[model samples]
Target: MSKVILITGASRGFGKIWAEAFLKRGDRVVATGRNIEALQGLSDQFGDQVLPVQLDVNDRQACVEAVNRAKEHFGRIDVLINNAGYGLFGAVEETSEQEARSQMETNFFGVLWVTQAVLPIMRAQKAGHIIQVSSYLGLIAAPVLGIYNASKFAVEGLTETLALEVKAFGINVSLVEPNGYATDWSGESAFQAKPMEIYGPVKDAFQKAVSVPGFFGQPAATAEAIIKLVDAPHPPLRLLLGSFAYPSVRKVYEERLASFEEWKAVSEAAHGSN
Candidate 1:
C-alpha cells in the first residue's frame, strides 16, 4: 500500500534512509529537517512523492503547521516518525539545567508536540502509526549519557501510554529502541558537556567505549527494521532495532527483576497487610 509518511531529522542518518526507502517503494514522504538545502536532493530525486520541509521540532507551532502542510499536500498522513532528537553526552551533575532542559525539549516535548498534532487527523482517518526513534538508553542508563538517557526514558513512557490511549482510535504507537549505530549521532549530531575534574575518568571510559572499533552497527539495517514494523498489520509497542538491543535491554530488565524480588517481602510488608 502506498502511504503518506512524515519523518523529522530527514536530512541525514536513519531518517534520510527511511525517506529514500519509502519513496522508492512508492510512498509519499514528507521529509523535514532544520536544513532545507540538505533535503533538496530528496525532492529532486523523488519529485512530487517527496516534500522536503524545513522544520524545527522544538517549535510546537511549527510542528502543528508542518502537519497541516503535509495533510494538505498528501491528504492524510499514514505514519509519523519522530526522529529529530540528538544525544547529550554528560554525567547528571556535569549537565547544567539549561542543557538538560534543551535535551528534553527536543527529545521528549518535541515528540509530544508532533504526536498531538497528528492525533486528530489519525482519529478522523481511523488509522495511522507513530514511530518514535528512541535509543536503547531509553531502556537502560549509562554512566555519562545521563541527560540523553533521561530524555529517551521520558519518550518511552510517553509512547507506551500513548499506544494504550490511541489504540481504540486505530492508531498504533511504536518505540524504535536502537543500540549504537554508525551515524553522525556520536560526532557532530551529539552535544558534549563542559568537563568536570570529578567526572574525567568516567567520561574517558564512556568515550573509549564509544570509540571501540565495530561497536556501532549500521543505520540502514535499523531503517529496514522500522519499515518491517510499519508494514505489520499490528505493529509492536516497542521494536528493538539493533542486534545488541535485545540482550542489552534484557539484562537491564533481569537486573531490575532481581532487585524487585530481593525487596518483595519488604515491599509487601509496607502495605501493612491491608
Candidate 2:
C-alpha cells in the first residue's frame, strides 16, 4: 500500500516538487498552499492522487479544515510536512512589530495548530513522520535577516520538543535546513519595512546577497531529500541540505559552544541539584 503525505506551501518550490515526486512514486499527496488557483492546477494535472487544498495557514480554522479534508480524502495521513513559510528580510530593529508577528503566525503558530489538529489521528495510528521545513537561517542569525531568522529558530526548538513528546508513539520528526533552493524563492520573499534607507550600505549589501536566485540548487534536490526522509526507518533529527548549510551550521555550533563554555561556571552555580 502506498503511503499518503500532506505537504503545505505546495503551490510552488520544493513543496510542489515533493508532492509531484511522491505521486510519481505511487504515494497519495495532499498538497496545500495559499494559492488556490495554483493548487487547483496541480490537482487538474495529477488528478485524484494529488489533492490540492487551498489553505491560508495563518487562518487557524483554515488549517484545521485542511487537515480534516486530508483525513477525509486519504482516511489517514501517514506524513505531515510543514513546508509553508515565507522569508521577511530586514534587521530585527528595522522590522515592524506587526510584520514580525504575522511572520510568526504563518511560520510557527500555523505549524503548531496543524500539528495539534493532526496529532489525534497520528497518535491513533501509532506511526507517522513529521517533517518541519526550516532554513539554514534557523541555526544562525544574520545582521539584516534577524526577523526571518527568529521564526525559524523558534521552529527548530518547537520541533525538538515535539519530537520528544511524540517519540514513544512512533512518530518521527525531521528538521530540514536547506541553505537555498532554486525556485520562485526570492520574488516570493515578503518585504516589509519603511525603506532600506535606514539600513544604509548594509541594506544594499543585503539586497545583493538575496538578489542572486538561480545559484542555489534545484528544488528537485530538496524534494528528493524530503522523500527519502519520509521513508527512513529511523531518520535523523536534523538533515542539512546543499553545501552551504554544512559550514553555516558548523559556525553556529562553534559560536554557541563558545558562549556555553564562557558561561559554564555561571550555569553550574545556578544548578540547584548540583
Candidate 3:
C-alpha cells in the first residue's frame, strides 16, 4: 500500500537510505535535514516522489510547521520517521551541563516536539505509525560516549512509554536501535573531542573502533528494516537495526537485572523501621 512518509534528517546516512527506500516503493516521501545541498541532491535523484525540506528539528516551532507542511502535501500522514539525531561524545565529567543540554535538545526534546506536533493529526485519523531512530547506546552505556548514551536512553524511555500511550489512538510507536555502520554519521565524532589527560590511556581503543569500516552500523540495512516495519501487519514496539545492537542490549539488560538481584538485600532495608 502506497503511503505518505515524512523522514527527518533525510539528507544522509540512514535518513538518506530511508528516503530512497520509500520512494522506490512508490510512496511519497518528505525528506528533511539541515544540509540544503544534500537535500537538493536527494530531490534531484528521486524526482517528485521525494520532497526535500531543510529543517532544524531542535526548533520546536519549525518542527511543528514541518508537520503542518507534510499535512498539506499528502492530505494526511501515514508514517513519521523521527530520525534526526547527532552523536555528542565525551566522558560524563568532561561533558559540561551545556553539552548535555544540547544533546537532550537534539536527541530527546526534538523527538518530543515532532511527536507532539503529529499527535492531533494521527489521533483524528485514527491510523498512523511513528518510527524513532535511536541507537544501541539508547539501551546500553559506554565509558566515553556518556552524553550520546544518555540522549539515546532518553529516546528509548520516551518511545517505550509512547507506544503504550498511543496504542488506544491507533498509533503505533517503534524505537529503532541501530548499532554501527559506515556513514558520516560519525561526523565530528570521528576526530574532534575534548581530550583529557586522564582518558589518554583508552583513547586509542575508542579511536580504533571508530576507524573500522562497518563498525558504525549499516545505513541501508537499517533503513530496509524500517521500511518493512512500517509495512508490517503488526509491527513490534522496537526493532534493533544492526547485528550488534541486540546482543549488546541483551548483555546490558542481563547485567542490570543481575545487579538488581545482587542488591536486593540493600533494597529490602528501605522497608525496615530501623
Candidate 4:
C-alpha cells in the first residue's frame, strides 16, 4: 500500500532524504519546512505525489494547520517523521535563558505540537506511526551540548510515554536516536551560543571531536533504516541508527546499571525491611 508520509524539516538534510526515499517507494509525501521554497525541487521531480507546505513547528497553530492540510490533501496520514529540530551548542551556563527556551520550543514542544495534531487522525483511522528523530544526546549527554541534550531528553520522555498511550489505537510511536550524521545539524542548522573564555576548552574539544575523520556518516543509510522500520510489522519503541549510537547508548545503560548496583546498599538502607 502507498502510505501518506508527512515529514517536517523536509526541505533539506535527513528530512529531505527521507522524503525522497518515501516518494521513490510510491508513497505520497507532504514535505514541510519554514522555507517551503526549498522544497520546490521535490515537487517538481515528484509532481502530484509531493505536497510542499510551509510550516514552522514551533507554532502550535501552524502544526495543526499543516496536519489538517495534509489530511485534506492525502485523505490519510500513515507516517509522520518529526524531523524538525536543531542543535543548540554551548555549555549550560553559557547558553542564555532565551536561547535555551528557543531550543526547547523547537526541539521539544515542536514534536509535541505536531504529534498532538496528528493523533486525532491516526485515532480515527486506527493505524499510524510517529517517528521522533531524537539523538544519542537524548539518551546520554555531551559537554558543550547541554541545551541540545535537555531538548532531546524531553523528546525521549515524550515519545516513550506516547508510545504506551497510543498503542491502543494501533498508533505506533518510536524514537530514532541517531548519532553524528553528515547533516546540517551541527553545521548551518545549529545555533551556537555567545562564547565565553571560561568555556574555550570545551568548545575546542567539541571542534576537535567533530573534525575527526569519518566522525559523521551520510544520511542515506539512516533514511533506509527508517523506511525499513516503518514497513515493519512491529517496530521497536526506540530505534538507534548509526554505528556509534548502539555502543554509546549501551555503554550508558551499562554504566547506569553498575552505578545503581554500586549504590544498592545505600538505596536499600534508606528503606525499612518489610
Question: At residue 209, what lDDT does model 2 achieve?
Answer: 73
Off by over 4 Å in 2: 207-215, 266-274
Error of 4 at 194 (Å): 0.6
Q: Spell out the clash pairs found in candidate 4.
A: none
The predicted structure with the larger lDDT, 3 or 4, is 4
Report the candidate with higher TM-score, 2 versus 3.
Answer: 3
Error of 3 at 110 (Å): 1.0
Stretches off by above 4 angstroms in model 3 are 188-191, 208-214
Model 2 C-alpha lDDT per residue in residues 154-264, reported as the tens digit of each score: 999999999999999989988999887767665655565665566778878866875676547767877678878888899999998887789778987999999999999
- What is the alpha-carbon lDDT of model 3 when measured against the actual structure? 0.83
Model 2: per-residue Cα lDDT at residue 153: 94
- lDDT (C-alpha) at residue 2 in model 1: 96
If both were scored by lDDT, which would come out higher, candidate 1 or candidate 2? 1
C-alpha RMSD values across all candidates: 1.1, 2.2, 2.1, 1.1
Q: Is candidate 2 or candidate 3 better by lDDT?
A: 2
For all predicted structures, in order, the TM-scores are 0.97, 0.92, 0.92, 0.97
Error of 2 at 243 (Å): 0.7
